[model samples]
Target: MTLLLDSEEGARAWIGEAFAPTARQWQQLDRFGAMLVAENARQNLISASTIPTLWVRHIADSAQLLSFDRDNEGLWIDLGSGPGLPGLVVAILCDRPMLLVESRKRRCDFLRAVVAEFDLRHVEVAEAPLERIETRPASTISARAFAPLDKLIGLSTRFSNESTRWLLPKGRNAVKELALLPEAWQRMFHVEQSRTDAESWILVGVGQIGAKQRGK
Candidate 1:
């Protein structure tokens, strides 16, 4: 796959062919995008300037995560899922059972409303911080613009086992963030170029946290 999607048209085209959403899924996404814009008027769900490029910037950016998750996995968990960028987007496009963890009340309300609106029975909204939520083995855990690499791992390690896959979109900070990790963790994750932006990058990894020794 090409590393970077240079234009809005390219990103949109890539997402359509890459995921190939059903008619119903496309409807859900279209509705969700409209709802997101309406909700943004009420509160700061997303930046106003990006509204024009919503399809490529938000929807397609979120959809690109699916390319990394070929197996569909078990339970997909999204931490600090404010506005459900990839979480709701993923649930809308796929049948994977998902949990969206967000601590803010208003955001949680919005997320629940979307869930109800779409009747997404497989998706659950956890209105709490990651530390407060109960632990369950996560087949895939994703966080976008969440905490720093070390802090995120510190908070979420309990939910991961050896087979767990961590997909973190760190944007331009991907390489710098990965470098800050302990040597063991640095070995676990490798950065991948993002399809949505040439300057952006994603940190992808698989393994139980702390399993690898610092020097080994």
Candidate 2:
């Protein structure tokens, strides 16, 4: 894997090269980053140590998921979206309809505040866990540090159909987590090196996942 985007400037340049956000989108992202920093002091939104590299570690890390789902077909469900990682980031950058599922009330409030602040009409917040949320098909499903691969698949399989795409940022454990899945599920997903970290990885999968076969 290549070196990570270590500096803010490098992250900006990479984002520009990849997505080329409009002026308005850039403004939204900037404000969102500020909000995230401010909120982090009150709640554990993200690691305090990563504050210096917020752009590269969090913002860009989340933004990178968009590349995997360029078609933007239908609803994008972000499970356990504590601080909206890619879900809110994706909403700010584009008009993809999104549902951010976060179980905690405080985080849900924060997410709703961001949606209202930005007037992100395309996004919705489900203030509940994955199991309690109503079942509906999703075009793309994303999870970051939500759960291990087997448990994550079992919990999320209900929302996916044949065409749903899974974009999970499992960090450095991406390969190990994918390896632990049953053989069929192992075939359903593959790992992609993260642009922001050489050792980190993102799990990408297309097609629906089955729940029954997921076990130890």
Candidate 3:
């Protein structure tokens, strides 16, 4: 579903939440957007179709992720964090440490540029496949447009713990994917509607997801 851009500016108005960014935060978001726009022309950081609705589709979609963390402490891992999205967005929004995992060298460069530009001390970019990369224990994890639910579980298993929660943005197919997951994982996860897009849903998983592959 294509997101129709509103003239109101910023995603806070559209998200229907009490999200408020200081002037500095908005400026930082603007710089990040500028960097994406500039680099996207050279490397396709984001889809060409999303340029107009970038704020609502990307920034807002990413920003709302922080609301899921009850502790909001420890590290937050963003797997396959293409162009930063929620990982950088969450890092800029709060003071918690964020680990952004990306495989491509170019994307990692772009993320590092943003971190340097913004002086984001809380953000770290890991440039490798999730399986090969050594992952720190994370309090929560997020992935956007990365992989299917089952495959995501397979990749993220190493980073998760007894308390680690998973936040995945499943646009319109949340129900179908939930149905496809193994029965053991059924009890551990639930879906929540996205505040930005009504058609989108955020899948939140608690505890361990796979039973058969336990301790693997």
Candidate 4:
């Protein structure tokens, strides 16, 4: 695979020195990447074609979530964590408890392996669909390239509370999706251009949600 970003100790050092200023958890992040690639060869978790772009596409993409709440505490959950994006990265960079929700057995195994390899004390992997897992109201919930905005909100309704913040890494269709949101939702969010892709965007929202409803 073409190496878009460094995958060695140097890369870890670079990420630690550059992005994760408060923490030096790059070693764990690197191990997480390796675990993803190794398991991906057996079954599809992330697109195999994106292997070459792991650094910018996966690592940097996930790391950017940190910019949202640098001092975030409480629990953070990553829904549909195919290859553990912002969840694993967040666990390494921040001190909060983190959970990765994935239904596929193979992917869950891979996540567990990475967590073990890196000795990530605060990160846990739940090998069940998002609907079945029980989580307290999260301080932050991140969904990376998981589902459409409306659908994601529907699916993650259970985990959202008055204090929950949503961090969604979306693509070119973000604005269009935002326009389509129901007016009754009564929330405020900002759209920022992605650092890795010009056509992509990151959606950040914080506010109280309406009463909880059954998710799809």
Number of the predicted model whose TM-score against the real structure is largest = 2
Model 3 alpha-carbon miss at residue 41, Å: 0.5
Model 4: lowest-lDDT 10 consecutive positions: 1-10
Please list the residue runs of candidate 1 whose C-alpha ends up more than 4 Å from where it truly belongs after superposition.
Answer: 1-3, 6-8, 211-216
| Candidate 2 off by > 4 Å | 1-3, 211-216
lDDT of 2 at 20: 90
Clashes of each: 0, 0, 0, 0
Ranking by lDDT: 2, 1, 3, 4
* Per-residue lDDT over 94-213 for candidate 4, one digit per residue giving the tens place of the 0 to 100 score: 778998998888778877877787778898899887778875788888999678888788778678776778888878888888877776452457787766677788888875455542
Arrange candidates, best TM-score first: 2, 1, 3, 4
Positional deviation of 205 in candidate 3, in angstroms?
1.7
Better of 1 and 3 by lDDT: 1
TM-score of 1: 0.94
For model 3, residues 1-216, the per-residue Cα lDDT tens digits are 434334337465644343466778878988888888899998977888888878877887787778777465888989899999889988887878889999999999999999998999999999998888785788898999789988888778777888888889989998899888767776778888886777788898877654474433
lDDT digits (tens) for residues 1-216 of candidate 2: 454788999998888888899998899999999999999889999999999999999899998999888986799999999999989998887787899999999999999999999899999999987899999999999998788888888889989988999999998888988887778898888888998988899899998765555542
Residue pairs whose backbone atoms clash in candidate 1: none
As for TM-score, the candidate ahead, 1 or 3, is 1
RMSD of each: 1.8, 1.5, 3.2, 4.6
Considering every candidate listed, which one attains the maximal lDDT? 2
